[model samples]
Target: MPDTTRARIQQEAARLFVKSGYHGVSMREVAEAVGVTKPALYHHYADKEALFLAMLEGTLAGLSRLVQAANSQVGIRLQLDTLVYELLASAPEQRVGLQLASELRHVSPERRAAFEQEYRRVWVGGLSRLFEDAAARGELRGDLPPAMLARAFLAITYPLVTGAPTSDPQGTARALLAVFLDGATPRQGAA
Candidate 1:
């Protein structure tokens, strides 16, 4: 189903939620923002948390596809570069939707757990496969665990993925890859 109203609700709600945090945005505000009556909005979503979860789940599922496609490239380095570039290339609203996962603090514990399962299954699991392969091949340095390595990559680059204007995504991808694929320490041959 095209379901434009539902999609619009998610889009508008995302913009509102991004501008104002989970607690900051309310159902009435979301309804107003979406130009839908409270009854209409409630028809689509049970309540605020459900709407929030739907938005988050939808974004994460799309991102999971992007990550999988990026991972199709020959090597992990190329994949990482593509992944960061793809994310940076995504619309601000979409990036904000991805970042909204961090706002799980306000939702019920059950809701939080549900989102966590989807996040881990869709978002983190998409990236974890690369590290798992790399580790199996003994390509990853040190004692890095596959899942931890994936999480570390997210920890390092996500701020840029959602924050301030990025003048150069390729350059940004390169810098992030440098720190993640390489390290902050000086090269062995550096002066």
Candidate 2:
């Protein structure tokens, strides 16, 4: 049989996890929300923590794909502008996993470690590559670290959970790009 049940489980479970903190929801509730028996949910995920980890992994993978697409752009400015706009334009529910950023403590150390590794490798590493490539081309300041620049770039997007999805992603993209690039660009006659 197909694993459509797994997909259904993830959708319902993500809603539940986003609605309630990691500790606030239970396996039974997830099963109930998905209209499946506890056994069916368990067959897909070992436990609540496992389900949460899966959600986090999916979120990272989605973001990694976004960054990968942005890399095809010729310039760091275009790559970052496009990435930010795409993220801001995304459905709020699509970011539900990351929106639960504060609840990661409820997850076990081992699982958290694994997710952190993947997060750094795919998400942060992907953004860092954009800056790294730009720095190699002398398009950005070599005096600063690309990872630091990448983190600064990402910090702007963290507040996304509180606001409505952008009605004008392009204008927002332009405004955001101007702010970021203004700081990131090198100074010609600095003492």
Which model scores highest in TM-score? 2
**Which 10 consecutive residues of model 2 have the lowest summed lDDT?**
93-102
What number of backbone clashes does candidate 2 have, counting pairs of residues 3 or more apart or in separate chains?
Answer: 0
Model 1 misplaced stretches (Cα beyond 4 Å): 186-191
C-alpha-based local distance difference test score of model 1: 0.83
- Backbone N/Cα/C clashes per model: 0, 0
- Please give the CA lDDT of all the candidate structures: 0.83, 0.81
RMSD of each: 2.4, 3.3
- Which residues of candidate 2, in runs, are more than 4 Å off? 183-191
Task: Candidate 1: count the clashes.
Answer: 0
lDDT of 1 by residue, 101-188 (tens): 7787888999898888987887788788888887676667648777899889889877886688699989998999998888899999
How well does candidate 2 score on lDDT at residue 81?
Answer: 78
